[model samples]
Target chain A: MAEFDKNMDFPELDAYFSKTSEAADDRMALLELLKRGAVAYRGTEELRKKCLNARELLPKEYRYLEFAGLQKLIEKCKIFDLKNYSRELIKCIIIGVCYYTLFQSIAASAVIFILCLIVMVGGGYMTHRKNAKKLETYYNLAVELRGVFPELELEEDYCSEEKLMSLYDIVQANELTSLESAVVKLKAIG
Target chain B: MGKEIQWLSFKTREQKQADLDEYTRWVFKYGQPQKEKVEQILSRLFPKEAPSMAMMTYLLGRDAYYGRYNTKKSSDRNPIKDMYDVLSKKRYQVPKKDIPLYMALIIADERVSEALDYPPDDVLHVVAARLMEQE
Candidate 1:
């Protein structure tokens, strides 16, 4: 069995396959696609046929499981990528060190804590602002629809008991929050 | 060789519709009143524009999952159980301290609902429980 190299890029894989394995890049690409869930295994006769046909196009030794092994490597690289974890760990350590240093000086610690709090609050506020904009967009779209369909009387006649009940049903079924339920209610009313 | 991958069958159109219908009925029974309360909160939060109800519903659902539902752990040290410790102490009056958490929960719920395609009513119950639990 070939040892899987985590550090190897696509080009490296291609080179290795071309030199050692008999399978061409096309077979590799198909396997890669399937591994990514871009193509479904079942009910995909065309793809299955393509893979089968392509197998003959390649060397017999560099067939089925070899192709599957490469696909699994591709998936493993995607799933267990340590970059995000490494970055987060580094950030936590840096923050911990900074806090420790700040604690050495009580005045500095207070300032640092306040600064961190401000940053967190500001970030939260910014997020809320973004949500507000989304709400505005939805509101504007509703208003525009009302303007276009004035005869329908969207705001007034839009929310029938049946519609409200139905919307309520959707909220309950999904087990949504009060705010979520309200939003559905408003949509039904509109 | 590893275990063979088994592809689950997709739901039939009729089955999907029936599920949707059942879900909708449950939501109506449980979700409507909670929605009213959320609307009141939203109106207070954003006095300028009439807040989008759809967005609110979506947010509420998301928060219910992320904040409350997702926190459920099999271990004894469950953070969800001690939710009241972090919630507002004031029983009747909505304390200024608690409002932020409430608002945050609402926003979180919306995102979860949108991502999961959850029904609004289920989200509402979760939100109500989180809110009332604080009291």
Candidate 2:
């Protein structure tokens, strides 16, 4: 058992030591038992309380720590989910345009046979070809819009909200047929 | 020759329109809110207003094109290089942290591939990489 003081910084510790001192004449025996049981229990309880406090301090959105969890949900129902599908389709189109531009450059080199051979060896050729054509078609349509509305420069920063909204409105207005419907569906979800 | 001219009947235009309407309404009710929350988080991190709708559409369209296909190698032309050149000429600067959000948002719309006037993925990747370097 240890000495206890009322004004001790650790009042709980003082109280514990005092109780152990009263339990036995042999200070060492009483101190040993209290050290193993009471001290350990208090320490564990304090740790648990601290952990809860830390968790409470986090933002409400981050409290759940559900970024990956939500992503999994989105991936699970992507196709039927209009927003997910729209978003994915847009990504696909962007990739397609990159591929098309690259292909056009390669085609200009007049090494058509070499390009064909390279594509044959590449596992993604089929998907790449499909996306390229689709992006080309979309680009053509967008150029036509540029002709109609000269002020809306299609070649400016691609991520501007104004540009996105204008394109969304264009798509919503059925300017590009099936593609327009798809854009509208994406906006609805986004 | 006469058999080839037959118009196939599936769902009527009215039924298709109704389906589209219901789908759009549901998306707006649930998906839009979540997307907005994500965008808010991005704005706080980047301290910039979200990109304009037209810009987003074009970007998304570009992303769609790249995401779906692989670029062909050319002797004098690199698709990624071209993207960097185009982006460098743009007036607005796209910070790095916000690139993922932009990609995610554009990809969120399936029609992005059809909406863009140019390749978006290469430019997005270049910009994102540049932004990451600063971080």
Candidate 3:
């Protein structure tokens, strides 16, 4: 609502909020945090507040967020903000270009195809690198989760989105909690 | 407005204790072999000193979460993320592999680097990822 402050240096929300966003950044960032199982390590105040924000923005899968492929999922969301019907819009553009080029000149069609191929390759390579980084992050997260929950095991298939979601459920279930703050009154009473 | 936030409710003393009472149980009860290995690793890393409370808290927390003694409220928390947040605060390096072990040492032994301050992240991504690979 308030431009979301591009450089808002709130460490409390670093692991919880997204760095950049338009309007949905909060929602997306919360989703990202949930995917990384931030709910596990994140403290009480932050988790509760953020979950409240996410409850409306995200679907029901917040509790079972998986680190795997979430970048792509987020990217898909980002794509939507760029255009109303981005996928359909692109398809229309491609079809229009193809028809024009086919009638204009066969040589032009080949040239356009080559150009499109190069752009596609460049885009693809960028996506690949991005995916690799996200994958490594997922692995690192798996390692951290494994540290606490050995049953997570970090098997070869552990990186799969669905499998990781299951593991995240275990993380949520096995998180370490303290009664220090909440039970202070109770302890004093007893 | 949005749906009311249903963040996890805090556990009472009994509930919290019911969820997590002791750290030793990981070593003695569930993760005996891994505990030994982790202890050996800590000892080897810091021959002069034992791990600090912060480090032990995370290590043991992780073990208990994975082990049988964990509570139902355990699902609401995450020791790894907590530890990483603390460990990553330091302005130094941690290893990519066995980060949990190394962060425990770094947090335990403040002498690891001069730049590091307290309150590292709860989850240790990679030992070196904190310093060398800051995302």
Leading candidate by DockQ: 3
What fnat does each of the candidate structures reach? 0.00, 0.00, 0.00
lDDT of 3 by residue, A1-190 (tens): 1121222232422332222222234333433433554333333333333333443344444324564555555555334232434554465458547766668765666566556645654455555455445444544444544444343233322323443444444433333122122123323434
Per-residue C-alpha lDDT of model 2 across residues A1-190, encoded as one tens digit per residue: 1122212132322343344344333333423332333322332333334434443544354334432243343234222333434444454555555666778664443454345434442324444344344444333333443333333332212223443444444444443333234345656656
Count backbone clashes in candidate 3.
Answer: 33
lDDT of 1 by residue, B75-128 (tens): 533232233232323442344443434434443333332123222343444544
lDDT of 3 by residue, B1-135 (tens): 012243665656786565454535523343445455445555554455545643454453344334333344655544334445433434423332444455334333322112121223342323334323322
DockQ of each: 0.01, 0.01, 0.01
lDDT of 1 by residue, A1-190 (tens): 1222222223322333344333223334433432332212223334334444444443344333332254443344334333524544454455645886857765665566556544554454554454444434433343443343233232312223333344445444544434244355656656
Give model 2's clash tally. 49
Q: TM-score for each prediction?
A: 0.19, 0.18, 0.21
TM-score for predicted model 1 compared with the true structure:
0.19
Error of 3 at A169 (Å): 20
Which parts of model 2 have CA positions greater than 4 angstroms off? A1-190, B1-30, B50-87, B91-135
Highest TM-score among the candidates is held by which one? 3
Which of 1 and 3 is ahead in TM-score?
Answer: 3
- Model 3 chain A worst lDDT window (10 residues): A1-10
